[model samples]
Target chain A: MTDATASLGSAKTSADALFQRKRLTAFAVPAVIIAYLAYIAIAFDVVGLAQRASGENAVILASDSWSYKTHVTRDNRRGGTTYAIEGERKGAYEDGTRPAWVSGDEDSELVIDLEDGHVVRFLPDNAVAYDVPGFGTIEAQLVDGSLNTNLSDPVPDWINLSDQRMTVTTDAGRLTMTRTRTEVFRYFPGWELFWFTLDSPYHNRSFTEIALGDRIDPDRPNISGAMSDFWNNGMWRHKDVAWAIGETILMAFLGTFGAAMIALPLAFVAAKRFSPFGALRFGMRRIFDFVRGVDALIWTVVLARAFGPGPMTGALAILITDSGTFGKIFSEALENVDEKQIEGVASTGAKPLQRYRFGVIPQIVPILLSQILYFLESNTRSATIIGAITGGGIGLMLTQAIQTQKDWEEVAYYIVLIVVMVMAMDSFSGWLRGKLIGRKD
Target chain B: MTDATLSGPTRREVDRIQDSYMAQVRRRRMYGGLTLAIFVLLMVSGFVVADDRNAGGFWDGWRQMLDFPADVVSEAWEKRANLPGLLVRYFPALMETINIAAVSTLIGAMVGLILSLLSTRGLARWPRLITVFRRFMDILRAVPEIVIALVLIFILGGGPVPAMIAIALHTAGALGKLYSEVAENADLKPVEGLASTGANWTQRMWLGVLPQVAPNFLSYTLLRFEINIRASAILGFVGAGGLGFELRNAMAWGPGRFDEAAAIFVLLFGAIVFFDQISSRYRNKLTEGQ
Candidate 1:
């Protein structure tokens, strides 16, 4: 009875110790996490980041991504007013033509509509009146190399009045007057010139009208002409964008399959059962490690120098890096192949090559194909990044658009397309895997 | 011998079976041949297209490939004494890159853990919103890190912060999927037991489910950390700030700065291989019992 009591006491003590450990762990983990985060916050300079971050840039990016601004510029010195979308030359309205929102032209007083009950009138001589319904009309004149504005002493935060320049910001739009130019930007939702440019005959036509109605451009068929116009849109560069997406996918495809093709034989040599020479197998495995360790970004830089920046460079970068990965994976799969299958094939009076073909290939093909398909999906994303470095795909276009800083709408479009493209590839690869593996089984 | 001993009907049956087997073999061979032909065609055409579109043809480029590497090596050899100093100078940048990856992994893992729990059918905070969480994670995973990094850099300005945020988002989606797969297989009895004791959803999850999946979760998170390190370095090339940023600056000089580039290359390669070895070791240990 005494012995049993002692054993029970020890067991209870052990159980209590275990509970104590668990309790300590529960608190310790959170404390460690908090400490680490605190360290990171200091290392990353979270406090200074607030000051460094540009609120203006943030606001601009947020607004510009989903909206566009049509620039109505009145040349203070040149005595002419020009209207352009996003103030780009490519999106410029032809001479004597103006947006529907702008009623008149350079020849006459132009009345600009800003929607939301805001209107701006370009009067006879470099004078502008902006009517904010809530506030009074803010009048500005660009006289002899200076901007003169009529406002009270205490200017509203939304309006900046100066001798050299006058600026007004409202919900409807923005207006700025300077010695050289007076410009009003009328904000609009949706990406303009995405489907058709200013010069296209199908510019303002609805889709049903283009598809079902008479040919807008008499020279070409309606549907074909619309497609041609949309594809060749100078503002959006849809043709270029399509080619870029194609190039990105092409890079991924060529890279993944090419890597698989190159790695298969090497993997065979690297595998223990397939190869007799240990030194050679070790060498091959080391080569794979070296290649993989060097990383894709490094490989991309090296290959871009050799290939001089294109889809080829991107493909080669992915190819070289993924070859290493596939080699490792394939060799492991090869090593794991059941010896009984090969023995069975050998017992059928088959030669070594035939034995591998019948035995090893069949066993590993499912794993190999599944891995290849998985890599194909991921390589598409890698290809985009590599393409940025090597200068060949949608990544380059995206970088170019973002670098311009003002083409936020274009940037947004590319982001959407990239996300869609990646998801599509992912699904495509998944479906292919299902079909192939299902057939195999 | 038994078949020969059998009557005419049995022999005819044998012949019919042989004929059907031959037809099956013929059809399989034909399909195999067609697939091989198509693969060959695609490879040849893809190579041609890539070659044609390349700025420099393969023949010209392959010849000059060794030139760049050779030049860098020779220049670095001449400036061998500066190598250690250069490496030292760039150590902080490497540290920053690693920090970006580490911080992102930590944050991404926590969010992913939550997301995985919410998305898992048997273990969910909101069962009705499973599809919504799944789709949200899918979008997060689908968005390339560079896209987010570039856009965020535009808004937040250039730093490791943008890269960290971008990679964290991607990692959350990736780890969430893997975690949910593991979580889905976890035993529901413990959870039910905890629920019977009146444990809340979070409490039940914390006590019952997390211990079961923690090993797999840690392994995946470690693997993701390895990946994010590479990603963070690459992002730095686009001016996100890290080793890749320094490498870019070194490479931009074109000739005189080859030694700096060489030093950065060595450091980056060493760091990648080192972390890769460490994470793989730990991952193997984590998954060993399971």
Candidate 2:
């Protein structure tokens, strides 16, 4: 009875010690994590970041993504008004034409009736008047080489006035007057010139009219003309966008399959079971490690210098990087192959090549195919990033658009297309895997 | 007469079987050959098209492939004395890069843990919303980090925050899928026992489910951490603050600054290799159960 009691006491002590350690570890891990986060917060300067972030830029990006502005400007010296969409030369209204919203002629007073009772009038002598619905009419004029505006002593916060320029901001529209010109901007919903540029005859035509009505352009039929105009729209560049999307896909395809082809033989040499010589296997493995270590970003930069910026350079970079990864994976798969299959092939008096073909290749083909297909999907995304670095494909266009800072609509368009493209590729690869591998799930 | 009749019937049967076997072999060979032909055609045509669209043709650039590397290396070698100073100066940037990866991975794994629990079949908080969560993760995973980074940079200005957020978003989506797969196979006995004790969902998950899958979750998280480091470096190249940004600055200065670029390249490679080794070692241990 004394011995049993002593043994139970020892067991309880050990169990209590185990629980104590576990509780300590559980608390310690979270404490460590919290300490690290605190350090990072100071290092990253989260406080400063919050202050530095611009709400105005976010507002611009958000508004610009789905809306466009039409610029109605009167050249002070030239004495004629020109109307343009987003101030692009391609979107300029014809000399005799104007948007339905604007009234009067270029030679006379131009009245831009911004909706919601906001009106911007371009008077003679490089003068402009903006009538805000709630506030009184504010007038500005370029006298001598400076802008002079009529306002009370304390100007409203919305109107920014100076000797060189005057800007009026309101919910309905914006107006600015400088020594050289007076401009009024009217905002509108949806992308401007997305279907057709101002030069196209079918610019404002409805789809129903285009489908049923006679030819809008005398040179061609209605359907074909509209189709060509939309496809070749200079501002949106649908044709170019299509080509870029295709180039990105091509880079991924060529890189993925090319790497698989190159890696398959190298994988064999790297696999210990296949290669009897240790030196060759070791050398091959190191080569893979080196290539992988160099990484796609560095490879892209190096190759871009040699090949110049293009899709091919991006493809080659992906090929080099993925070959290393594929080689490692394939070699691992090769190492894990069932030896009995190889023995069976050898027992048939098969040659070395035949033995490999019948024995090893069959066992690893499903693994290899699935891996390659998966890489193909992922490489599409990699190709986009690599394309940005190499100056090719949709990524190049996207970066360029973003850098311009005023083309948020185009940026939004490209982003949508990229997301759609990637998701489509993902589903495609998944479907192909199901078809080829007989669906593991 | 009886022996001759049996021989004739056996010979005919044997010939028929051999003919059918030969036909099957021919069909298989034909299919294989066709696939090979299509693949070869696609490769050749793709090369030609890519060559046509490229600013410099493949053949023209092939011979000069190693020239840039040689030039950079030679320049770097001449300024090798400054390399140590450059590396020291850039060490902080390297730390920032690693920090971005580590923090993003930590936050992403936490979010992904919740997402995986919600999406996994037996562990879902709302069974009807599983598809919604899965699709949300899919969309998140589909967006390239650079796209989000660039957009964020415009609003947030050039800094590491954009890169961190972009990488975190991607990591969450990727880890969520992997974590869900592991969670799907988790033994539900502990969960049932906890449920029987009148424990709430959160309590059951924390006390029962988490311990059962922690090892696999940790291994996957480490692997994701490794991937996120590479992603953070790449995001840096596109104006996000890190070593890649410094490398870009040095490269922009041209030949005279090659040493700085070289130092950065060395640092990046070393960091990547180091993290890869460390994470892989830990991942192996976790998967192998200590």
Candidate 3:
């Protein structure tokens, strides 16, 4: 007893002498993983990563200046807005200081808009050449202050602002508006030409207001022309983006429903416990594994080769891929059914067919239905991948938008639409899955 | 004594019945043959449609896989300058994505474990909760990883973080559902014994319940790891970065770099297979020991 106690004491001392024992690893596995992944991030340049396919076509399509004309309207009911922007081709490069259209960038074309019958056109900051409808062609520099041309010498009656704000002598009358940052008509007038040019820091604050206090400063440059151009044109830029999103939705639905047709039925025979025959079951199971092992993009690329191009390619590719996935899932569900019910049917001297119909199918229907609904939700996103490959959907449009860097606003617009779609799908699927499985959402 | 007279009528009736049955069977056989023909026709049509679309370069892309070692090693080593750029751009994104995945998986696993614990009959009178959780899992699992990524990207913006979260969210749902099934179907005798002793929820779960389902949970988590890794790689295609970004770029701009894409793809697939094999073997050993 003395030796045991002594030994225990010694052991305790030695253990204490060693490193402190940790209940949890101070350096979590996630931390290590994060570090390792950070190494990979170091290798990739997110900004440099190109989102669009820069082919010969994209290269040749490049322009010095892109002019956009637009018409805009609001939909208060849907809480949605609609507009159209038309790009007029340009020739030759222009000064970099020129006021580009709003939401213009490298990957996208010119954007424009019209609000309350007033037309606005947005051009790229680097636009060298421009095409106009009635006026032939005009070249101009980007200015910070507002200037109105072609509206007559005296500003028109519609141009009336608080008379004391500022006076502009025109053919019709003297019209003026106060230049204040808080005014809805005002945007950042001048800022450094960066990647997101024009939408930079210069618009919101008036130089006159900041420098002259209560009075308008003589040094405040007028960017009214640039602002007017942007406001008039930028509103209509979202239409193209909307169209792109619509295409993606179509691709997803067609692919998902078609794939489900094959996957759901095949899942039954694939389940080892419920299979009609061992060989059939094994074969189906193997088929599922093979299809699912590959990436969907790989499938898309493959199908694109087989089918050529267009929405059909995207649809077929998704079908082939989803089949394998749904098959395995459905089969597992089949295997999990209560065997007692199956046995009960069997003891009645019913054939396999009758037993399956009465005992197996009904019990598994909800499971299968739930699976199908989930896959449908999944396929919608996959449709976007297909779009990337075939250039047929919103993904393709997004790629274009990213490449030109001309339609960031459109990019934002499409992003909103896609989010709304996916969220809607998620909610609907959750509800449906709950209903089929007899559970709450 | 009556056998001869009865036999004569029975023979006539049997002949009439047999003749009608034979005719019906012949008609049914023709219909069956037509149906089979239609089924075959549909299969062929699907195949043809698939064929006409894209001849599928994945098989061809495999050929590029062979060029990987030479090109990757050369480019990686010889182009030392580009290496820094590549590392700078890729490593952080990769780490961010992985972190996202790890955190998500950990949280998901906990949720799954908790649900599994609650699924036991003794813990609580909430069969409805279990049922609801299971269906919630179905909804969660049904959404494609890519779709999840896309939605998250929209909500969170383009980054590795969102991709990781997306993967983790789905993993939680799937793992939770699977874990619940494992718990529900576990041997209950010990559970009953523990209950008889008046064990509390946490205690019963720790000592009586967990020991039974630990192997299953481990195996599932490992399996999910393999899946999540592949998912992480692909998330890059949607602006999430890793090997997928490289693959996308290759596809988009530089087909010549396909060798790199092929190499990365091979690595991903190999990693999955290796993890699967190791996890399965380990799991089998564990279950055996248990």
* Alpha-carbon RMSD of each model: 1.9, 1.7, 16.7
Pairs of residues clashing in candidate 1? none
Which regions of candidate 2 deviate over 4 angstroms?
A: B1-14
- Better-scoring candidate (DockQ), 2 or 3: 2
Q: Is candidate 1 or candidate 3 better by lDDT?
A: 1
Off by over 4 Å in 1: A1-17, A104-108, A439-441, B1-7
- Please give the distance, in angstroms, between residue B23's alpha carbon in candidate 3 and its true position after superposition: 32
**What's the lDDT for all of these models?**
0.92, 0.91, 0.56
Candidate 3 regions exceeding 4 Å error are A1-247, A275-283, B1-228, B238-241, B249-265, B275-290
lDDT for each residue of candidate 1 in A56-114, tens digit (9 for 90 to 100): 89899889999999999988887888889999998999997888888875565778999
Residue-level lDDT for A100 in candidate 3: 35
Estimate, for each residue in B1-290, the C-alpha lDDT of model 1 and write its tens digit. Answer: 77566768887888999999999999999999999999999988998988898898978998988888898999999999999999999999999999999999999999999999999999989999999999999998999999999988987888999999999999999999989999999999999999999999999999999989889899999999989999999999998999999999999899999999999999999999999999999999999997
True contacts kept of 2: 0.69
Ranking by DockQ: 2, 1, 3
Selected candidate, larger lDDT, 1 vs 2: 1
DockQ score of the complex predicted as candidate 3: 0.08
